[model samples]
Target: KLRIRTPITTRMTGCPNGCARPYVAEIGLVGNGPNMYQLWLGASANQTRLAWVFQERMNLDDFERTLEPIFIEYKKSKRRAESFGDFCDRAGKEELERVVNEFDPSQSLVKTTAKPRVSVTTETMDRLTRISDIRGLSPSKLANEILEQYIDSLETTVHAQK
Candidate 1:
């Protein structure tokens, strides 16, 4: 017999920037505020990885009230020892969207605004050039590496404090 384990874990408050690797969990509830949450679902160890943002800015009270029924349905229909991610893959995105819409009716049809591009001035370019020369790398390559490291460090610091 294959024994399955399901545990509900909690993180006080944090952002999902892959620093904490929240997408690896079966059910991840991220705090958006005092009483708001963003629910992440269907993450697993298999390479078939995708975590859908089920709800955004959902009131914690509302989430608690709504989650039980959905979970019950999953439990009832789940295959013998099928993981949450497997179940979600089998269920498909449309069904997941339907489930989420039932909880938060006012689904934002609007797409997220794209981040404004940072124009690289001469001063910025010169600084990047100097760093690249010192590191023996091309300016473009150095810039990319620097940006990646900077973002990772920022996320780590932010999560550490939380």
Candidate 2:
């Protein structure tokens, strides 16, 4: 589990069906119910390993309390541009547990589900699958928008002619 991260991204999900695929996310949180989430970490982005359960049945307050100190320690411990999942894998379970146990939740600043969800082009999805990485945003949104503008312009010209 000490290998380098193949991708650099994060994700979140509110679906019980695991729509966000938290099982393989570097930092994945699945919503169990109102204000309750399950935390998973140390997953390889390339789907090489399913993430381990770092914590379960966490409330917003608990999420904040549990994650902040680990983040701080990661900041101190990580190599250049290393990701959370990669850091988690290299740090090992015992060390992560030690950090989790030591962190005081009172100091947490962001105490809720905080990762972004984005849509992408099918082409982008294909590239992601090919590359073993998950960049959160999609280039297709922009492409679709521009295509709409072009269509509108064409329609305007046809309408004027008619």
Candidate 3:
């Protein structure tokens, strides 16, 4: 179904030995257990980079249902005649992960809990409160926004260095 609906190659194996060359396939599935596999994606076109495992485990029965929506996005939004490897590269891992998240059959498998309270110096807390008040947001939300921006900048810097 994956090959029929999308122009990407998929390779699967029944064990972690990776004999199927899942590292180079557009969609790599290495078995984790009976009827279960670990999913990977974003291998470079030249096979210079191995795919990254995004899902640690998933049932084979969930494949089509989970991946079809992602293929639909690729079909509707990709450049004309772009191969899945190139499309995955162009879309970037984060965006593709967002598409995959929509069809996650194990959504409820993850336990959701309120974020734990973070420890901060009194000065930092006061500053955050003041900035958040001016921005019309809760202190926690403002702090999250600030952290996300910092992480983005840090990631860009780290990637640039490498």
How close is every model to the real structure, measured as TM-score? 0.49, 0.55, 0.54
Candidate 1 error regions (>4 Å): 1-13, 45-48, 97-162
* Winner by TM-score: 2
Pairs of residues at least 3 apart in sequence or in different chains that clash in candidate 2: none
Q: Write the per-residue lDDT of candidate 3 for residues 30-118, one digit (tens) a residue.
A: 99998798988777656776788767887876676556656766776778767676677778777877886775545333333434667
Worst 10 residues of 1 by lDDT: 104-113
Tens-place lDDT digits, model 1, residues 1-162 = 122364433223476565555565556677777768787667654535756666766776566444553564466677887776667667765786666457443432323344344569999999999989999999988878988999999999999999
Write candidate 2's Cα lDDT for 1-162 as tens digits.
Answer: 223343644667998687878888888888878878888888876768778878777886576667777777777798887777878988987899899898766655554556555667888768655544344445455445556899999999999999
Error of 1 at 13 (Å): 4.3
The TM-score that candidate 3 achieves is 0.54
- Candidate 1: global Cα-lDDT? 0.64
lDDT, residue 7, model 1: 42
How far is 83's C-alpha from truth in model 2 (Å)?
2.1
Cα TM-score of candidate 2: 0.55
TM-score order of candidates, best first?
2, 3, 1
How much lDDT does each candidate structure score?
0.64, 0.74, 0.76
